[model samples]
Target: MYAFKKSLSMGFDQAVEHVVEELKKEGFGVLTDIDVAATMKAKLNVEGRPYRILGACNPPLAHRGLGLDPDLGILMPCNVVVREEEDGSIAVVFMNVATVTGLSSAEGMKELGEDAAAKLQKVHDAL
Candidate 1:
């Protein structure tokens, strides 16, 4: 699959809360929240399913990556998402942190990304 998925028994709000809590434990802080459902409705006048994009970041890791490669800001703030399935289940997912790091081609970025990926995986696993 192109994405990582974790199903949760909790409702949408509760699932999001759990994700936030878990992310914090992993040293990630949410920097942005994009409510795709609401944005699409307001911008395009079209209706769609529920979806959200959360921009997450670990300041120390980000700083290290930036110090190694000055242009790494393009990949800063990892993304996490939460959405409702058709069957009323909630699914939480995130970008593979290691994958983004690999895109940098910087010497130390791979290891940094791998460590971030491991933490993100734990967040998903907790859900």
Candidate 2:
């Protein structure tokens, strides 16, 4: 699958905090955070579920990837999503790093991807 997902037994706000902390522990820093629900409400006057998209990056890993392939910027920061389900549960989802960076033909990029994926898996396992 393209994503690694897990349900968090906590409120939306709490889940977001926990996910961020876990990511940080895994050497990732949140570069961007988009509040999808609020954005949709403001821009289109439409209501949506509580959803957030976090663009996370490990500078060291990202640097390595760039050195291998400058074009790696296309997948620079990995995306982690936190959303509240209709059942009142929250779910955390992160993209599969190995699968994403696998698109690159650059050597050693896959190893970097594997390292990243391992860290992210740790983050998920922590939850």
Candidate 3:
């Protein structure tokens, strides 16, 4: 299994909305939204199931992580996902903050990642 997976059962749109709300509660904001399903359909003329990628960021946490290690920005914001399963269930998933930010060597960044991971886990659990 990949290091960055957490799943919650919900409708696709509802899952996305819930994640956005939960992330906001954790002081993070959705900065980017890419509708994989729509994009693939439009760009590649390929039909696929529903999927989306959300880029979330918390400014204070980002600042803290960057302060610890400049290069940590490469893994900043973390990615959250929403996809429809074959069984007609929606699964919302997010990057494991600890795993993704662990790529950095800065201890402070690691700590920040751990904190963020806790918040994200809480959000997932709430879902």
Candidate 4:
């Protein structure tokens, strides 16, 4: 699977903040925050539900991945998505590091992927 998902029983803005806090507890930081809905509205003049794509990174883990393969930088930061459901509920989705890292054959990459995935799972469970 490309991602893990969870429903959040909170307001959209609150859920976004909560996800960021949970990620920090796991040593991850939000490096980039893309407001998809707002961007679409500004660029394409389209209407849509609230959605955001957060680029999350753990500096230590990213450093390790880079040391293994410089090209791995392309996949360094994982993406987490926060969006509102049609029913007005909030949902958050986390990137599956294992699935993405499996594309590389670098030594110890599998273990690294598993480690990151476990940490993300903890954040998922925290919600």
TM-score of 3: 0.90
Off by over 4 Å in 2: none
| Candidate with best lDDT | 2
> Global lDDT of each model?
0.86, 0.94, 0.82, 0.93
Better of 1 and 2 by TM-score: 2
Candidate 2 structure lDDT: 0.94
Query: Between which residue pairs do clashes occur in model 1?
Result: none
Weakest 10 consecutive residues of candidate 1 by summed lDDT? 1-10
How much does candidate 4 score in TM-score?
A: 0.98
Per-model RMSD to reference = 1.4, 0.6, 1.6, 0.6
Write candidate 3's Cα lDDT for 81-122 as tens digits: 888889888877778888787777777767887898888887
Q: Point out the worst 10-residue segment of candidate 4 by lDDT.
A: 67-76
Better of 1 and 3 by lDDT: 1
Question: How many angstroms is residue 16 displaced in model 4 relative to the true structure, after the best TM-score fit?
Answer: 0.3
Compared with the true structure, what per-residue lDDT tens digits does model 4 show for residues 82-105? 999999999899999999889889
Q: lDDT tens digits, residues 1-127, model 2?
A: 7789999889899999999999999899999999999999999999999999999999999999999999999886899999999998998999999999999999998999999999999999999
Could you tell me how far off, in angstroms, the CA of residue 118 lies in candidate 2 after the best superposition? 0.4
Score every model by TM-score. 0.93, 0.98, 0.90, 0.98
